[model samples]
Target: MSKDTIKCKYIFEEDYNPLYVNGAQGGINSLGEIIINFYLERNALPKSQTFSVENGKISKENIDKVEPKDLKNSFVRVFQNGVVMNYQTAKEVHKWLGKHIESLEQIIDEQKDKK
Candidate 1:
């Protein structure tokens, strides 16, 4: 892993299957997607925004028309690293993090300091 890219690996139960969930899921899905998505949605600024590309250019009009949807219907595939989190799982993680944020933040800070 390079300094600019932080890679974390998590092993969840197969039940956390991304299939029957979202599409193109996995990798840093937890600390990056799942947790971030949870808060973004809660704040009414969900991360469902998407963009379209044509002729090597992003279509601004398409981005503006993006919308949110149920995660299950969001995609079709298996997560490679972290698993997809349903609303229940997301809420549980959010609550747990609320109680352990300081510790989590400290770990992140430690990683950053490693340079």
Candidate 2:
């Protein structure tokens, strides 16, 4: 090996945790850079809950918060994090996503032909 040669390895921090998101919302800021907030969407949850016990095997539960009448069609979006990037990075990401999306569509078509 040459004297100037070097090797490198990457490792995640101790607090590193994978996040799952299905939604994104944001726009540019005063600096003109793009701002994207990733989030997860799901049914709305009760604001609070309570329970009561009478015997070793007897119990009851109660939800203090009254759910809206339209709760059956209600939903919630919980933002996990946000990322900021310049126009150049956004264009690169756009191209990369388009290529991958086209490939995925082709794969699905091929699978359908096989069936």
Off by over 4 Å in 2: 1-11, 49-73
Local accuracy by lDDT, each model: 0.55, 0.84
RMSD of model 2 against the true structure: 4.8
Q: How many residue pairs clash in each candidate?
A: 1, 0
Estimate the TM-score of every prediction.
0.22, 0.70
lDDT of 2 by residue, 1-115 (tens): 6588678989999999989999999999999999999999999876544566677653554444345545556899999898999999999999999999999999999999999
Q: Pick the candidate with the highest lDDT.
A: 2
**Local distance difference test, candidate 2:** 0.84
Residues 3-94 of candidate 1: C-alpha lDDT, one tens digit per residue: 78778999898687442323332334444544222111112333566778899997774434556545334543333343466667777877
TM-score result, candidate 2: 0.70
Q: How many clashes (backbone atoms < 3 Å, residues ≥3 apart in a chain or on different chains) does model 2 have? A: 0
